[model samples]
Target: MDEPEPERKVNGMKSIFEEEIKKIQDEIDIFKSGSPNHIAIISEPYSRVEHIYNRILGDNSQKINNIQIFNPVKDTDFFSNFYSNQDIIMMQNCQYLFSRKCCGFAILEEFLDILFSSNKMYITGWNKFAWNYLKEISNIESMFQEIITVPELNSKTIMNLIMSDVSDKVTFIDDRVSEDKKFICFEECLIRMPLSNKEVNISEIKFNFNALKRKKNNKTMEDIQKEAFMDITTLAGGKYDVARKIWKKSLKDGEVRLSRIPQPSEVEISDIDELFILGNILAMDGIDFDELSSIVKNDSLLKQKLYNLVNKGLIEDSDRFYKIYPEAVNSVIDELEKNRMVW
Candidate 1:
């Protein structure tokens, strides 16, 4: 597992929406004034949730020295030394409290019951997918008085963030401009994919993250994606994290032109059982390798499927926890449905 992120990285150095920060501050102000209010900050995994928390801390640290932050997933001393003077408790990774196939909150029920029932102002960060799952299964959303989700990025914002990093190598070339059609192009280069000898021509364009899979009104979800740009954000689906990963991957050979948009993946499911298992993994957001293995109940078969999925670039392994690749998540969902692996 990755070590805890350094505090300097999250201590109000990142830019966040002023209006959203103001709203959070308002909620905190109300709670401090003895109002029954609590806040839940849910964000996309790897997105900018901590920056928001830091912004709140930057603005209020002097007034609330009794505040303490905890990580429910890793911290062991949280419950043992709970102090009554701690009026504000910020907990990160509250999603770890729930388990897909475990016995009753995995011994986290008491901690949560106590944390939520306290009179303090609780600002907890949660994974968006997990929060949604819990909201559906357990009505977990009802516990929070205010919910704030991380804002999606726009093409302009993405361009600003990326260009700042690789400005020396990139040049935004305008291909064609007219009242009827406008095209923004990028400098191109040939780069070899990792573990492959074939050098492919490519060009990279920074796009908004939110546009990754968003469909236009009345448009059918087509198998083949057309080359399109929306205010420069069309390809990314408004997720800056996804765009950054793509850019970093493309920067190995001094900056390759983003020549191709990622195509839909066609992962092979070897059997009915494999198909069902893949669907279950996706439906559960993601699962640990061990958790998935126990559910499948066959060491050899589970290992084989994990190998196949990872090799196909449809599944990812991060610290033994596996999930469908972000780029392939929607495709896998659709493929599973087409095969009737899931309803």
Candidate 2:
């Protein structure tokens, strides 16, 4: 018997998640075999590192024990006592251990000392931008025995992930014109001649006959879904959170049209204060007002800069914490790089 659609989608998403978890598990297994080195999992803001960490603990509950999870916020005290019976420690958001100010490394140094001296196994999650900065300024990279960078999801995986969780019936509408629906295209490429050692520009015709046939008739639900998600994935740069945000925006009254996928607005950042504020937010992943104020030093100036950023739709404030908007992560990163604020 054929599997139900929801069940099939669940299984597909599970397979993709398992594939990602397996890579981390393999590295963990090596550490479990009496390796002295601890593990570090790093990824960009809004990536799947935290989700994977939780899944690992949940899935291995029977086999893995004596584990404690710690999620630290700004000005967190790392000197707190650990459970004596706990054999493994998992620390999330280690970026909050330090600020971007003078004497910022004090807490980080203390934490590293505890980490290095402890006999228990350690697992840490870090913001990728923060990790890079820390690596450049300090010897933090050498401390981790194994480092795992979370992989980005492809268009197919993103589609499966989004669809699997959707219980409501969603209709995918293909609103593209005939020209936009073309399944064949011509492209020019440079090829080197083997004997002459010279390159020649050649035009090549590429065809997707199956897609063409579908276009002539009615497109299958699967084909329409793939095309919509492909556009979403490209716009999201394969980040799950960004893709999901796009999905939610595209959906209206249980219908998702191809033309409804939101495009990222242009971000303009010229002020030096705005650049610094954005850099701090990106590096810390998510930070509260006080912590950010500590980095910026001037409370009044910081408030105005953050307000401007929020108005620009480049970042959002939740409670007291500020984070880059899911869709604007790439744009913010590009702006920071242009200003040489981030490496």
Using Cα atoms with residue i matched to residue i, what is each candidate's TM-score against the true structure? 0.64, 0.79
In candidate 2, what are the lDDT values of residues 263-330, reduced to their tens digit? Answer: 65566788999998899899888788888877788999999999999999888999878999998998
- Model 1 over residues 10-49: C-alpha lDDT tens digits? 4323454566778888877766534447678777644545
Clashing residue pairs for model 2:
none
**Whole-structure CA lDDT of model 2:** 0.76
**Which lDDT value does model 1 have at 219?**
38
Please give the range of 10 consecutive residues that has the lowest summed lDDT in model 2: 1-10
lDDT of 2 at 160: 77
Top lDDT hit: 2
